[model samples]
Target: MTLTLTDETPPKGFERLVRAEDPASGLRALICIHSTALGPAAGGCRMWNYARWDDARHDVQRLAEGMTYKNAMADLGLGGGKSVILGDAKRDKTPELFRAFGRAINALNGSYYTAEDVGTSPADIAQAATETPYAVGLEGGQYGSGDPSPFTAEGVFQCLRVGAKHVFGSEDLTGRQVLVQGLGHVGMSLAEKLHAAGAALIVTDIDQAALDRAARGLGATVIAPDQVFATQMDIFAPCALGAVLNDTTGPQLTAKLICGAANNQLAHPGIAGALHARGIRYLPDYVVNAGGIISVAGEIHKAGPGYRRDRLAGIAGRVDAMLTRAEQEDRNTTEIAADMVKEILASANRNVA
Candidate 1:
């Protein structure tokens, strides 16, 4: 169930912890990097039934590193780390398993903190807290502290506006035909913003309830989840899993811009060149989808007592600026935005050094 490929590079400050209790219930965590340059590393734990252990390991490593860059780019004073549970969410989810994972993290003291992500929820985080006090996003009866999907979607929405301005001449979403490839929590939240902007929405989701919700509430036109490969729209928003822009789908895309909350949109590194060839403006995932982490980081650091909404609204403005700078520099938005973030981190590193 648990598979790992050891490498020397190990992603700067990588730490892998595995707790084997039985063949069926093993917990594995990979903390890809430490941002002692900033502060304690904090991130969400993603639980999924990856087909292979290598797949889960790869996902954890890449996502953890992405979180580091995302936090640095968003000016969050926190490092990045991620946890992955290798099992089916529906059938394999047990409080015991989560508790085991929490104990594993507890052993690390506070080097890597955990929250809710993907298949994990607030209740699961609460279960995790039963073992480790480091877990966040607890339910205190009022509004839950977990489920940061809407915040993530809001950030992506802002980034999309910036992309629209760069690709077209306007930042408004009105009259834009936006095709959303995933109807998950983030995608659905983003759909509300697109609808509010008077954009024509084309939605796709494997979950019928989510599709129905989008159709009934947002008046969005639902499409088969796989049909996004051939959908014709100004923007192709991928809010779900990563690596959708592979060789097979990249060449056939009709969207002028590809900007969304999904991480690692390119199936491979060369896909960027291919998207560049197609004139598709690619917004780097970490830069665009950082609102959730920013919010959680604020909570974690006690940055402020209030102003959460205003802080979130500011992400849109920053995204818009990044988009404008990319067009003015005549470079791919992904490269430009990522380079800016790298410069910031490099500066931070130098000051520390």
Candidate 2:
């Protein structure tokens, strides 16, 4: 009946990791606040059925840390944090469960804010907000940013176009062979955009219905999940999970460019270099996937109309600029992006001092 929350020891760089459990609503959640150096941490609430408790913690830590870089890259005045509920998104979600989770978030005292993510929805966020004012992304009310998936898809679409220019010698995607790996809300929106741009889509997903929809609506060629890495395509978009571009998959990829909305696409530190050595241009995921966060941030800061539009428009410029700089420096784009994020953080610190 009562929510039980315990403060866990975070990893080296993390600020706090809180584990929350509530038998009343069957809620088991972890909220990680990686940093608040910029401002209150802002990120989404993901409800996934992780195989192991360790996996859930790792995912939250990686995602929260990725947000620190992502927010800085987007030029937002906020820090990074993330929360995850361990369960089946489809079968386990309940309004009381989300309210329990919301109480856990409120326990942080505004150090973090939450919205819809991977297995969560705007409707779920509305439930959470009933117990905490920090819940965001509800399109139904004032200052709510609504669903951020379309905005996220837009940002990644910009990266896709800009990356295409450098790799294919043209910005147009007409007839381009693109493999979209994942058909979730953001992934499906991205596929439609690419189909509109005339891209020949090769789609894969665990859900057969989603695959069928893509095939029926967009005329996409459905592929098995096992062949995702080995496929020869112009571009490979990973919209599902992180670390798909690891040592093994990176070498197997025949795609010219890698661009997607998934966070922490790189499995480890050196994977980017290997992709670069193979002459494959890797667009940094965080540098481009900040649209959803920017939308939520507008609500957090309560900026008036057009703020989301203006910020979303800047994603294209950042993607193009990063590409140009990477070419000029002959360095991997991830390194260049990290340096740029560091500069932004340092500048913020200096202004405070």
Candidate 3:
């Protein structure tokens, strides 16, 4: 089925949505540009075997909007955009396909910059860069930032400390029990950080190899993937796909704090309020996960690695300030973070006007 722009209303503040198909390469992709008020839109390109075209569209829309907020909050001088290519990552990737996708990005003329997201990698961005200069996160290049997963994990680790301090009255993770879902690159890196800090880890992943590796390498205990929410732990860190904190899992959550690297962790907007009502101090995903984009933006702008590392190191302080404000105002952290983004956007709009 061909993806079409229908009469249905677009997400509240999206600037543009492009659905494209390349018959030769069998590429079905959606690119969403949420805002360019601050600067050109920038986001990673995710490839997944979406169950439906609408699912891919929805993911792109939500993720792109989140990038807008993320970049704004990070003061990156970048707007928000995202691209999704529909396919099984393990089987469908081809040089021709990504090259074609690169052409599509180039056609945007820098309005949208693509990097690696879930099921995509820095190497894949390198492949795409063979055709477009806008591709980033490539390895070993002058401006290449390489894989950003480790940096992302570092930011999340810092945010976890901030949450610990706010909720448990200490910034230490020592002796804390953390349940980490999805042992992917970011998850594994985060697990290592937590383990090094003397945190007890309960981890789960769909891939047995990854699960075993985490268990053996990090001394983490293994749990069934579906049983994560029911497990008693101080922190539930979702490093996997989005929407894990949905209707089904919300009520079963045993964690006092929810902080992770997953974008759009809430299945619905209401999940934030629900978590808040349960006294779960939810760290906004974008706020915690902005490290990757911050690194990518710095690389693209020729900022040194030291500069990027400095910024990533500051994520905890930024998150702590937001969390403090949320507590003082008696508001959900998600709301507080969104208001911060909105204020930045408003300021940008005023400057442009």
Candidate 4:
């Protein structure tokens, strides 16, 4: 089947959405650039076996916009962009496929820079680098940041500390209960951090191997994936796919706080209000999961070696400030964060003009 771009209305606020196909490698890709107010757009390249072309487009659009907020709030001086390749990560990835994708990125002339996310890895990015220098997160490159997962996990962990402080009057995680959904690289890394901090963990994953490893290595209690939302815990850290906190799961959450590395966590904008109505404090996903982009941006901008460490260290304070502002202004965190991004973007645009 020929994958074609949908004829639906273009995503609001997006500057460009480029769809490409490589017949030779059977590759179909969508690159969405949400903004360039700060600078060139930068985000991850996700590879997944999307069931439909429209699904891939929607995912790319949401993710790209989230990156805009994430970058602006993180003060990265970068715009937002994302690329999605519709294919299975393990079975369909090929050197030719990434090269074709890289060529597509290069065609943008630095309007978008690609890195690793979801189903893509550093090795896959290295393959894309063969065709275009627009890729980051490759191993052994002069300025590459090998894997951003650890950094991202650290950011989430720090945000969890902030949430703990706000909701429980303490940042200490000792003896706290945390249910971490998804044991992928970022999730597993976060589990290790939380465990080391003396937090009891209840973990779940679609991959049995990953789940087993978390149980054995991290001493996490393994639970069925379907049981995550209903589980009682102090914190619910969703490191999995987007839209996990929809109508079905929102009302079922028993956790006091929600903070994680997943992008577009809310099924829709109103879900934020729904979560707030239930007295669950939500640390905005984009603000908490910004470590990956911060790491890659450091390398791209030739920031010092300690840039990632320093930036990650500041996340807790940033989250706290945003939370405090939300409380003082009587608004949900989503609105507070969106306003912050808007101010930054407006200021940048004014300076550019």
For candidate 3, list the clashing residue pairs, or say none: none
Q: How do all models score by TM-score?
A: 0.84, 0.87, 0.89, 0.88
Residue 337 shift from truth in candidate 4, angstroms: 1.0
TM-score of structure candidate 3 = 0.89
Number of clashes recorded per candidate: 0, 0, 0, 0
How well does candidate 1 score on lDDT at residue 55? 81
Question: Model 2: runs farther than 4 Å from truth?
Answer: 1-10, 19-28, 48-57, 86-93, 206-208
Q: Provide the lDDT at 75 for model 3.
A: 73
Candidate 3 wrongly placed segments (more than 4 Å): 1-12, 21-24, 49-56, 87-92
Write down the RMSD of all candidates, one decimal each: 4.0, 2.8, 3.4, 3.4
lDDT of each: 0.75, 0.89, 0.86, 0.87
Candidate 3 displacement at residue 270 in angstroms = 1.7
Worst 10-residue lDDT window, candidate 2: 304-313
lDDT of 2 at 210: 99
Looking at model 4, report the run of 10 residues with the lowest lDDT sum: 1-10
Which scores higher on lDDT, 1 or 4? 4
How many backbone clashes can be found in candidate 3?
A: 0
lDDT of 3: 0.86
Off by over 4 Å in 4: 1-12, 22-27, 48-56, 86-92, 206-212
The lDDT leader among the candidates is 2
| lDDT of candidate 4 over 80-104, digit per residue (tens) | 9999999999899889888788888
- Tell how far residue 174 is off in model 4, in angstroms: 1.5
What global local distance difference test value does model 1 have?
0.75
